[model samples]
Target chain A: MKTALRPSVALLLIAGILGLVALAFAWAGGWLSPRRIGGAAIADALQDNLGKPEPGWRRAHAKGLCVSGYFDANGTGTALSRAALFPAGRIPVTGRFSLGGGDPLAGDGRNVFHSMALLFRLPDGEQWRMAMDHTPIFPVATPADFVSLQIAGIPDPATHKPDPAKLQAYLAGHPETKAFMDYMKSAPLPSSFANGTYYSINAFRFVDAGGASRAVRWQFEPEAPFAALDKKTLDAQPRDFLFVDALKRLSAGPMRWHMIVVLANPGDRTDNATIPWGAGHRRVDVGTLTLDRAATEAAGDCRDYNFDPLVLPRGVTASDDPLLPARSAAYSASFRRRAIEGPRPDALTQAGEGGAK
Target chain B: MNGPDTLFAFPARLLHWTMAVLILAMLFIGAGMVSTVSAAYPALLAWHRPLGIAILVLALVRLAVRLTHRPPPLPADLPPIQAAAARVSHYLLYALMIAMPLIGWAMQSAGGYPVILWKGVALFPILPHDIVAYGWLRRLHGLLGYAFFLLILGHVGAALVHGLIRRDGVFRSMAGRGG
Candidate 1:
């Protein structure tokens, strides 16, 4: 023996050393016994940057119009989850399609990342509410990273553009952010709301009547052909063209999208919204969502609803995904802030009918 | 004393060089991650997260090999203090190699992020969700990275001294040239 240490002893010692350091880090970094991690604070920080909240507008997705619809469930949902909305029946649905970000007056032509929030009233009175986005992936992996990302995007006061240095630094620090922004840059922006597909982006758990559970994520896939206007045409159109065009499209016929649910394999990640299941993942078609009528933001019932994604029916439960709760907390905070701010006049309605032509 | 041609086992030598390149690459990639906001930021992250986990797993494997098989002892004429310094520094490097990735993984976990190892595979979190924990772990990860980088410099410096100045086989033993 070259040394007094046995191989097993040496191995154990090395493991002990590594473990010791890891334990030290866990203790020092406050990773042990995590509490009050400030999800609420992060939400507050994001809202603070949007200046004071205006009445009748959300902290984000401020430019939105609500529409009424019915979800025609074929009852396939019971196979996966015993949610009451999937009783092979029609359920009342109210939805809002909105522009991304806090500016209520921002034109639809200027935004690419749009949002859709839906509230489905099941027969038994339970509700399923979801706030989803056009993009398939979220920009940041965690709520903390989300805060950093938002803070970094705040434009410098001098240049009216966000400082490249700050963003660069942030990107360097959080590498998981690349896929989201890249998807935004590469994916075609929908020319009309009827043409866009919305993604939940975060995964959840579905428990069937037998108490069996499966990890799943969902997307609203538009039945309409995916189409987009060129930048030249987009620029020439009126600021509120999306809402106007959506209304025109609805008048012509109902707007429809398939509500598709995707299931994850054993090793698939159910917790991270940033990491998405690719195209090869197993999926099932739950039902069709048909939006039959549209109402102005002023007249829509959706304006009063918060649309928290966690409001699920009996069989559907939230997974350990941190974004789920973070989103819930933030949306509530945004709703609270806006509630206190009071209602103001909406810009689209002010321009009168046909203002977007 | 064994001849200057004595060397580490082939697997050890292989891991040494592979990890040398990977560690250096990790440091640079990590530095670039925090400094740029261009379109390439996401691309960098695509490589960063999985690479970090790879380094972590490899480090543990390397430690196993190292603990099981001892490297040839320092030259007989070498002073005790220098020998002790060399041993201490090697352990420090190993400690860093193992710690950095774990802290990063823990940090992400605490921040409610996933440690995606590849396109489809992801490792579970080592810590529970907490933004406050995430913040502290993030800072520590960066600080340890600086320490790791500096230690790497010192490690390279010592290797150069042995290879170029002292004419000892210490560097060559791990370099794969010596027996």
Candidate 2:
């Protein structure tokens, strides 16, 4: 019983114990984790490269046309997800078709990234919102890389084009972009929005009622069929040809897309956004997305929504995809800015009433 | 190892101290995670999650060990009030050790965020995803986290008193050489 220890020694020992506890905590919490990146910072970086965003416009996809429709769940997805929307029912949907750019006036003649965002209203009053892209794979893997790519896109004031040196540096660091660039060279640019297959390139988990789960990615396979146009053919069309073409197509009847859920096999990369899942995987045609009424931002008010891909129903949840939360954070940041800016009637406000951009 | 009548079994002591460190870190990490939306949020979160599940697993093993190998009794000369306080506090600690992680897992599940530990590794949600459930579960998790923190302070404060001031073997029962 070495109670012969002095008061100062005892107090110092106690302090040492507490300090060691704190040290252990810090070592685990700080040493193993990555530096946090705020969504607002991502948005700021995006806007810095893309130009001052049009007031009330989305930070990533500014120019968009709204369409209202319904999703008819075919019950096939019920085997994959326990979500209420999958039980063979019709769910109301509000969708927006947009081009991925900061500028609302960016030429439609140039083949840029096309985006399809959807907001589905479930019977339980919960909303499922997702923003998908025309490409099967995202060009960049992480938010930092995404921002770096955006910075590479920034135009030099004198030259009005990105500095070749910066572009080269980005390519060297992110060969994923180089691969994406190679694919884009030969990839078909959709002649119309209705012709493109929009994908949720980031993976998610679909949990069935039996408590089973699977890693999956989903896409809207167009019923209109795939049609690709060359740059020269696209450049010959009108400046607002994409939107004009959508309007003309909607005049016929409701446009349709099959919701195909692509299953991931064991060992497939779930955290990566740059790699598309290879073929020979099981695909489930889960539902049908029927887009009927087309409207502009003023009329459809798709501008009022965030379309955060993380907004999922009960049966679905985010996977280990690193980009999923980053995308969500960036979307939240962009949405927060739009909330502060307030909705403003843009040049396309009269588009629903037969006006031009 | 000391007899069960003297000190806790070695595995029990090891788990107690190891979990002591993990739980302390978890509490602070949880605090930092909620208090900010800073760039460190995700990093803090990454640590918070794995640590939580680890604590839960350790808690289960600790519980089994405790049930099978009874803890040594308090000192014979201890005052009645202090002994009762010891028993109650110890029980509460065990309850909290298990509850904290279970509640946290449910809260994250309700919020629709998967509790991912590593690349493609995750724990399934124990509860259904409902915003109302998520909202209340979140509040409950926050409340219990503070309660858990306060209990640790009392536990540590008393252990110091027994070791430094009172010079009782109670502190040594878990912290020192074979009792």
Candidate 3:
């Protein structure tokens, strides 16, 4: 037992331990096995109440107007990361702008969450795809909570609308939802998609050239000042008034937004999408996004893309926000369901005619 | 090799004690996290993630120390097979210590989650965003946690045998005190 140890023993021991660790990790990390839990059930639960979308429309952003745009980065983006889209160059962009409700035919005059999804096709042919909502904060912290939120919002057969009591109970149970409710009440509503600021809501890490990383949240703020429609004007507008207004405005001239990236300071909450980092965080105006024209959904370049938040480029990476992975999984499940459902027969024809007009 | 001069260096001993407390706290927090449906779940998750990352960093430092500074040899009176088993178990402990946090990180990253350490400080992802990959990593992280607990039990048992029954200095080399 009185044996002298060699220096080689240390190397062999370290390497052997590391090798075993890698193998164990691979087996556990699913390198050796397939996943059992899927977002399929969560997707089904979310869509169950909404019913199937009209064939040609998206399952989620069913009522959307697509647009083509370009992102002109200020070159200052290099100070943050080496993302190809950041250099002083213009990147072609295709995206959709829509209201939040699942119903394609929901009236524009109704109080609803608005959103946009963008795909910036980089010079290298790869893309940075992102989905953003007008709200500064999401209603829930995790996908499970979101599914529960959706189930709570499902209309009771007897009420023809989600039971107010159920919603109250759900809110009582999930107090994190109060932040979103507060935002809806306090935040200004935009007159058009052209005017509203769209927030990514989730946190992402931006790596600089030195391999150091900073957590960031970005928002697309309109170049035009935010103008809220008064209640009287909102009530005066027609069902498709918002859509028509955006179409006319974009057709007349380019609608522009500043891509504002906010860096998280120490103690900022990055994991909880429902929580907002303080407004005082350091902000960087990375670029301008301009949309010149709006196209009908069927003839649009962005009709097929899912706008997955995880579809990030090399410079930007997702944060451990539970919502990020949940969103990706749910998006996949939604995408599959839509593919299975197929497009409507007359949808393309109608879209063409609409575009021509 | 048999004297107090060979006891663990102060930094090594400090890391060992700190990590032992953290790993145990993490296990309890993790268990509480999975079982809770209350609002406290997120709070637990917030602690669990940062603590896991801290453990990973410290474990790497500890491993480097182990590689550079050879520990005191086992007593000559100890059986050869028992000595070999001791080496093997130490290797297993180190492996679990190093691998557990890393896989947890990879699991979160594969799910397209930022491995937020504290405040806004986040670790770069080791894996790409893939739900299937995330699912696998998650399950693996859970399974390995159980392995970690069992190994700790064995480790503690062996330490007790060296300290209490064998009247050997093996335990004191790391613990710095003999009962």
- Model 1 regions more than 4 Å off: A1-40, A231-233, A354-357, B1-179
Reference-based TM-score of each model: 0.59, 0.63, 0.60
lDDT (Cα, tens digit) per residue for candidate 3, span A71-135: 99999888897778899989999888887766676667756678889988775435688899988
Per residue, candidate 1 scores C-alpha lDDT tens digits across A178-198 of 666677666778878898889
Relative to the unseen true structure, what is the C-alpha lDDT of residue A57 in candidate 1, on a scale of 0 to 100?
66
* Per-residue lDDT of B58 in model 1: 91
Tell how far residue A151 is off in model 1, in angstroms: 1.1
Chain B alone, candidate 2, TM-score of: 0.93
State the local distance difference test value for candidate 2.
0.78
DockQ ranking from best candidate downward: 2, 3, 1
**Could you give candidate 2's per-residue lDDT for residues B103-147 as a string of tens digits?**
889976765555566423567778875444655676778788878
Error of 3 at B9 (Å): 54
Q: Ten-residue segment with the worst summed lDDT in candidate 1 chain B?
A: B33-42
lDDT of 3: 0.73
What is residue B145's positional error in candidate 1, in angstroms? 45
C-alpha RMSD of candidate 2: 9.2
Q: Pick the DockQ winner.
A: 2
Please give, for residues B105-135, the per-residue lDDT of candidate 1 as tens digits: 8976765444555432457779885544665
In model 3, what is chain B's TM-score? 0.90
